[model samples]
Target: MAKQDRAVRTRTALIESAAALFDSEGYELASLSTISERAGVSSGALHFHFTSKAALAEAVGQAAVQRLEGITRPQVDDALQALIDVTHALVRALDDDVVLRAGFGLSDSIERVRVAAGLRDKWQGWVEDSLGQADREGALASEGAAQDAATALVAVTAGLETLGRQDEWWLSHAPLTRFWQLILPRLAEPSRLDVLVASGSKGGAPGL
Candidate 1:
């Protein structure tokens, strides 16, 4: 049991160190030796856990996938409201979590032929599903607005994530709040608009 726990800890540390390096420097630039040094593990230990940098990169991506799952797992009573809160949560994550930023960055890397879908792809899919649900709930203003809103939402959030890497202000609550305030009115039915909180839920994003 102790050995298993130690292995888990070691693996986690390597993933974290690799994620930080990947975020600061692109995948091609982040070296295995540096990742091992940052993780405080011997090269042998790192090899025991991940045979190659590509393997380690996949682990980081999979870890990020788990986090994204947690973020999207909890559902609010209102579908549109949930969408607003999720966008807030996702941006906040991009700003705060190096792993998430790195995972997303990995998705953008042309060098890597990743086995799993990119984080951006995963996020866009979720946004589309949420908007579809909102339309079904009669929360949207029109029949086809969901697809349009999904595209805009994905583009805006992806832009914010990309820009936020340089300046954190792009990911802050103000920009997202303003975005929601601008678009929610147009996307939501008038009756639904009054109830939607542009910033987020009164409490916070679910599964936080």
Candidate 2:
């Protein structure tokens, strides 16, 4: 049991180290030797866990998906509030979590190569689902507006993460908060407007 636990830890370490390098150095530029060295593991051990850099990247992507699931899986009574909350949590996650940043980076970076669908797709799907729920609950001004908001939100999220790679301020609370402030009013019905905050709910997800 101890051996298995240690192996798991070692694998996690390699993934995290690779993610950091991938986040900072780009996937093509981050070498296996550096990843193993950063993880404090032998190259043989890295090879034992992952046969190739692409394989390692695939693992990183999968691990990131798990984290995304953790953020989006919880069911909330107010879906629009839940949407605001998850977006806030996601931006913060991108700001701080190298693994997540790398996962998103890798998704965009490795698009031509064959791999799983990108994390953005998953996030966009969740956004669409949340808005759909809001429409069902009569929180949205109209179904069409909710769809437009979903597209804009996903695009803004992708753009923010891209920009945040160069400047942390893009991922800071103000950008998303301002974005919500502008769009929420147009997207939501008048009665539901009071319930939403562009900055997110105090009762929301992990970041806030």
Candidate 3:
């Protein structure tokens, strides 16, 4: 039991260390030796857990996928509001979690080698599904506005992710708030507009 626990800890540490390195320096530049060193583990141990850097990267991507799944898990009552909440949660994760950030970064960098879908693709699918649900709920302003809104949301969020790489302020709730405020009037039914919070549920709260 103790040996299994130790192995689990070692694997987790390696993944985290690799995530940090991958987040800061692109996947091609982040070396296995450096990741092992950062994790305070030996190269032999790292090899035992993951045979190759690509395998380790794939593991990081899987970890990121789990985190992303948690973010888009749809916990709210309203579909539209759930979409808003997901965006807020995703930005927060991207800002704070190196594994998520690196997972997204690796999605683009190692597209050919990756066996699973990329984070961006997964996010876009979620947005599309959420918008479809909103349309079904009659929350949208028009009949076909869901598709347009999905495209806009994906584009804007992808842009934010890119810009965030340079300045973390891009990942803040302010920009997303402004975006929702501007788009909600057009995307949502007038009746539903007032009920939807653009800045998110956590916005305006102390220390948020």
Candidate 4:
């Protein structure tokens, strides 16, 4: 039991170290030796858990996916508000979590050849579904606006993620709040606009 626990700790440390390295340095530039050293584990232990860099990256991507799934899986009363809250939470996660940052970075990198799908794809799907729900509930201003709204939201958030890689200011909630402030009035019904919080709601989702 102790051995298994120790093994789990070692694997977790390696994944975290690799994520930090991958987040700071591009995947091609991050070396397994450095990851292992950062984790305070031997190269042999890293090799035992992951035979190749691709395998380790795949693990990192999977870990990131799990974190994202947690963020997007909650059932909220207001779908549009849910989308707003999620975007806030996601930006926060991207800014604060190395695993999420590396996962997104790896998802776009050539090293993701072994991974199934990127985090952006998952986020896009969630955005579409959330907006679809909002439209069904008559929360949207018009019938066909969901598609365009989804596209704009995805593109803007993607841009934020990209810009956030260089400047931390882009990752802050201010830009996203401003985005929602400007776009929500156009997308949501006039009656709903007053109730919706562009800065996001505090009740649901602990971090956001």
Best by lDDT: 4
Looking at model 1, the pairs that clash are none
Off by over 4 Å in 1: 110-116
Instruction: Give candidate 2 misplaced runs (Cα > 4 Å).
Output: 109-116
Cα lDDT of all candidates, in order? 0.86, 0.87, 0.87, 0.89
Per-residue CA lDDT of model 2 for 1-208, tens digit only, reads 9999999999999999999998889888999999999999999999999999988999899888888888885445799989998998999989888888888887875553233246878898999999998899889897598789988999999999989988999999999999999998799999988878788877678757
lDDT-wise, the better of 2 and 4 is 4
- Give the per-residue lDDT digits (tens) of candidate 3, residues 43-155: 99999999998889888989999988878876666899889888988887788899988888887765533733477888989999999999999999998899999999999
Better of 1 and 4 by lDDT: 4
Error of 4 at 1 (Å): 1.7
Question: Which is the better candidate, 2 or 4, if ranked by TM-score?
Answer: 4
Local accuracy of candidate 1 as per-residue lDDT tens digits, 1-208: 9999999999999999999999998899999999999999999999999989989998898888888887775357788999898888888888888887788888865355262346778888899999999999999998899999999999999899888988999989899899999998789999987788898986547533
**Clash tally, candidates in order:** 0, 0, 0, 0
Q: Quote the positional error of residue 82 for candidate 3 in Å.
A: 0.5
Cα TM-score of candidate 2:
0.95
